[model samples]
Target: MQHAKLKRSLTVFPIVLFGLAYMAPTTVFSTYGVVAQITKGMVPAAYIIALMGMLFTAYSYGQMVKAYPVAGSAYTYTQKAFNSHIGFVVGWVILLDYLFLPMINGLLVSIYLNAYFPSVPFSIWLFAFLALITIVNVIGVKIAANVNVLLIACQFLIIIIFAFLSIKGLLHGMGSGTLFMSSPFVNGDIPISLVLAGSSILCLSFLGFDSVTTFSEETINPKKNIPKAIFLVALIGGGLFVLISYLSHLVYPNFQSFKDPDSAALEIAVYIGGNLFQSVFLAGYITGGLASGLASHASVSRLLYAMGRDGVLPKNIFGYIHPKFRTPTYNIILVSIFTLSALFVDLVTASSFINFGALVAFTFVNLSVISHYFIREKQRDGINTIKYLVLPLIGAGFTIWLWTNLDSKALFLGLGWLAIGMIMLLSITKMFRKQPPELSIDHAEVNEMQA
Candidate 1:
């Protein structure tokens, strides 16, 4: 029996919308208070720095997708650029980012819902979101993409309304005496160290753009469209983050005034537009979280399918795609099961689990570019040295810097996860006597190119 592959039905626009959904355009609001407290009102600057760092990494991803356009993303790139053993480990590490992020979003949605319906248990909301998102993913990627577009539109509408209200509030003497001020970008007294620390957390808001590469196999003209989608997602998402944060900061110049930093964005909403608009804002926030969960679920299932096909995981399950829907049914179910953990974990802990894995994957992706072009190819493709070397070096440096600033608990948990992956690698390689298995993609590539 022949197995169906993921269909290449997605274009640049739908995939870009998918990327924004995965990033959850409204996440900046959820994280704004924490970032504001850290940056001392320089939230925009922190995002600006984080955006620059992610763009460099995005460039590296663009280069890699051109060479190996597959669903494995960082896993496939690292393996082809380096070795299978290292690739296995990279795939294992990124599972933290892929598998757990939807759960984090679920937890966030539950919290928002519980705020309104105080009597309903959080577990009910969590499971409801998981079930809905899982079903959408299992149905088809194109359908999921359509759902994302609708949900993201709602989120963007809410953001635009909030921006207008914030501007009006500022004009009415709600802020630092004028609509324009340098405090949101910088302050003469605030230390640069504080802003860098804030950027570390804000970087989480930028995580979803890289996941766009996971759709490479299911994208039309993967080589060209995948790169364009990746860049557009980063630029557009980062611009939204910076603009919203700047406006929020203008309306409430003093970060110390927040009663609870975690829910500061909601407080800003109430201040700007009163109770009715607060309800609208919450609707947008919940919609953004759901959209994010749906996109993340789809991306993670594809990653698992890639690993399963390579025999890195149990091929019977994770590798299997539905003959009718052409989707990874088993992997989608598996991720849905994992998301149940959201009922037990709080938002902070769940959110912390992802940053370590993401930073590690990004750091290596940048290095992979250097290894492929600078060391292995010796710039033989006539690729500019600056493109292969200088830019990626800067990207690597910034990601590593952010990695160091991760909270202690995140570092410990991430290291523990890596240790488990190392043991699994040893067992899979049969004590290092044989190479880890990999799927043969030469035939598929030839067919795709010919078509």
Candidate 2:
């Protein structure tokens, strides 16, 4: 049977904007204190290290997207580059990243909202935002992309205003001497181990860029645009993260000064701009969370659709696309159901579980580049050895190192999730007697023709 294909309507600009929205530029504030505590006020250094590490993986993603422009992101790339079983397992691991993201974003939205409206229950805001994000995604990716443009614009505006306020406050309150302190970048006294440890958490801010790969099928000239979008998202998002952390560090140099580490950014906002700007800051922050939730919900639905269409999951439901909206309606609703868990889960626990799956998928994407170029193709197709081999090796190594440094809770939860995926894989492949199911490029071409 033929299936409807996603509309190839997104351009490089919209996709990059969507990626930025998914990364949520204002997130540095939400987790600022935690990273500050870990790095001993060297948050910018942690972001710089994390950005460098992610760039290697981003290059791998760009190469793979050129080779296989499909909807599954890492899952499709890995499966095509390697084998069906490994791809199936990677798809499961990616589920941990894509599926739980909306939940984490929703929890963040609720946390920030609850802080402002102390009387209202958190569950109300959680479900409300989830429902809104679900509806927007179900309508269409184009609409979601458009919404992201506006939301991201607001976020950037708020960030610019905040930066100005922060600099002004710093000069007036702490003098010009404090403006260029090395404490935010490094303190010769702090151990390298602490900076690396902080990077493990800061890496979370960079998670959404790879989600751009999932939009390959929907993006115009995806072979060129997708890779560009991936690199731009990583570089732009990373630069913003480092800058914001540096400015924030200048505003509050003492890492141990926050009464509540999680909400320290909010306190800093009030200190810089007073109560009025604090309200504006909260509005912009909440908008960032909304943008993140919307993009994540859309990504997970597309991923499930890709998996379902490949027969890795039940195709009848997940593989169904809306004729009117040109979207995976059922999968969108399914992600909404998963997001309701945010009502019960706190931000820390929900946030901790995501890093493992992301790191695993990132490591494999690097390996996928190596497997495709070096192992199978054997002809780097005129591509340099550095692009195909050395870079990916470094990327894999860096991600592996970060994976090993995951929080103890994250490590346990990630392993448990992987164990469950293994069991499911056994059932699907019939205990290794049969190959795991997949959709071929030829089959996808036929479906596109039919559509």
lDDT of 1: 0.80
lDDT string for model 1 (190-278, tens) is 89888887787777888768778778888999999998998899999999999899889888888899876766788888888999998
List where candidate 1 sits over 4 angstroms from the true fold: 1-18, 69-72, 118-124, 127-145, 211-229, 298-346, 380-383, 438-451
- Cα RMSDs, all models: 5.1, 4.9
**Local distance difference test, each candidate:** 0.80, 0.80
In model 2, how large is the Cα lDDT of residue 68? 82
Residue-by-residue lDDT tens digits, candidate 2, 252-315: 7776987667667877888789999989999888877876677667767776787788787799
Specify the poorest-scoring 10-residue window by lDDT in model 2: 441-450
